[model samples]
Target: MGVFRIGFFNIFIYLCCAFLYSVPNVCGHNNMCFDCIDLEGCKAPKHFLKYMSAVDRDKVVLRLPTDKPDPMMDRCLNTGYTIKATLNGTVCSGSSDGLCHAIGEATTNFTITYSHCGDCYIACDCYSQENGNARKEGPIILTMCLAAFYTLIQ
Candidate 1:
């Protein structure tokens, strides 16, 4: 029994270490928006407005239309960008709440309705905090814990 207890404790410690190691890769940098640039230089003049939102692991890229003349191109040319995440129809910002972790860490369902650089706003789709590995990790961790527990008990 004592040996089993020690084994369980070791497993618990290992799991905790694993979770900590994986967390940084999952959370990533949030609430940062920036202009598009290539190795040669700025890509703003390519007709498509490339805006990337730094939220999760996968970068969310927005491509604006080039037809019919767009004022957004001029606004986003050489300026910084700001992103706002919305939760439950309420605007999330530095005042309301930080753009990425607006409501809270658990707040998943939200839309990045406002992504602006200079005077231009980039339209985006609904975003979820769960889109990151955090969501998938939960179930995986639970399963691992359960399996370990069952093995120890048996």
Candidate 2:
């Protein structure tokens, strides 16, 4: 009985550790990439393009606006840019805006892609090539660990 109890407690402790480590990633907010209006040569509010990750860049295409007869549209959206990865602190490329590029890969974590733009500020969408698997996996793993611990304790 004592051995069983110790084993159960040990399992519980291990599960607790797992849960603690994963909770932050699970509950953490998603990343985002935002494209703001141009802020150059205009007195209008400073609206700038913001790209959070590579996945988001793939979703949207950067094009000069032709819908309206506004000449400023082309200037605002057509700012040739490059993406830099914040993870490894490296510059990926000088490609057009909204292009995604793989920066680095990790064994336990997902591959990170960064848009040409640097750290984004203001409104933007999150980018993930793998359909947010990394964001979802953390919670699932924690839940499984907790369930196994509970079964052992009971």
Candidate 3:
């Protein structure tokens, strides 16, 4: 019983450390990334591009990612358009114009006139590729550590 309890506690600590190490520092300017757009009553990447095409038809060209979007990609659809981040142990959600606010988590049923990510021509996906990898290697390291730890306990 004692050995089992010790092993469980060790696993819990390992999980906490792994999680903390995985969080990115989130420094620099709060980057502008597409959270989605409202078009024809739909909030999606395709809609965002369509709306932009009409708004800046002569000035800019828009396209989807060449490769499939990474599952780890942060931007997605939600009600009222939201942004989320992590704190000590709590997950925080807020609007694009504000900090991690207390507006609560987003839902599929939310609505918004626009997400306010249209200030740049470079697109959010490009920005993600440039800076989103801050914690990319952290997951790989955590996995390796867990595998080694499992072997030790076995």
Candidate 4:
């Protein structure tokens, strides 16, 4: 009876661990949300915006039309560029060109990077124009404690 109870608990714990680890990656890559901070208020002449919300592993890419004339080109050109990310309206990371990662308590991290640029005028706008890609690998399992916790709870 004791061995059977132990086995059942172990199974339960294992399932719970799996569930928690895999939940963050489920918010599909192609999902788009407009009016994001990186897109809505960005005044750059030409900028590529990409964000990975803590709830999702895939980067959300925002593409804006270049046909419209922008008055902010002067500021954009002068400043060169800027990149920003936020969660719940709070700034998480900001940089001119580099990788920034913000780890939250929600079991995920938000990372943003800006790269490759030339003259910054609206007409001369240059950026690293590339399609964003997201790849998912199986959940990380690095602990016997986690496995035991997973199995015991089951």
> lDDT of candidate 1 vs native?
0.33
lDDT at 112, model 4: 19
Clashes of 3: 1
lDDT of 1 by residue, 78-139 (tens): 22222222112221122111121111122223333222321122221112232446777889
Per-candidate Cα lDDT values, in order, are 0.33, 0.36, 0.34, 0.30
Which window of ten consecutive residues has the lowest lDDT sum in model 2?
36-45
lDDT of 4 by residue, 29-132 (tens): 11112212222222332333322334322222232343332232222211232222212211122223222222122211233111111111111221221111
Residues 77-148, model 2: lDDT tens digits: 334332221223221221233432222211233222222232321122224433468888999999999999
In candidate 2, which residue ranges exceed 4 Å CA deviation? 29-49, 52-154
Off by over 4 Å in 4: 28-154
Per-residue error (Å), model 1, residue 34: 13
Question: What is the alpha-carbon lDDT for the whole of candidate 4?
Answer: 0.30
- The C-alpha TM-scores of every prediction are 0.26, 0.26, 0.24, 0.25
Candidate with the larger lDDT of 3 and 4? 3
Candidate 3, residues 48-147, lDDT tens digits: the string is 3222223223211122344333222223212233223311111212222322211112234323113232222133233444445666877988999999
Off by over 4 Å in 1: 30-38, 43-154
RMSD of 3: 26.7
Model 3, poorest ten-residue lDDT window? 86-95
Q: TM-score for candidate 2, please give it.
A: 0.26
2 in model 2: Cα distance from truth in Å? Answer: 0.8
* Candidate 3 structure lDDT: 0.34
lDDT of 3 at 47: 24
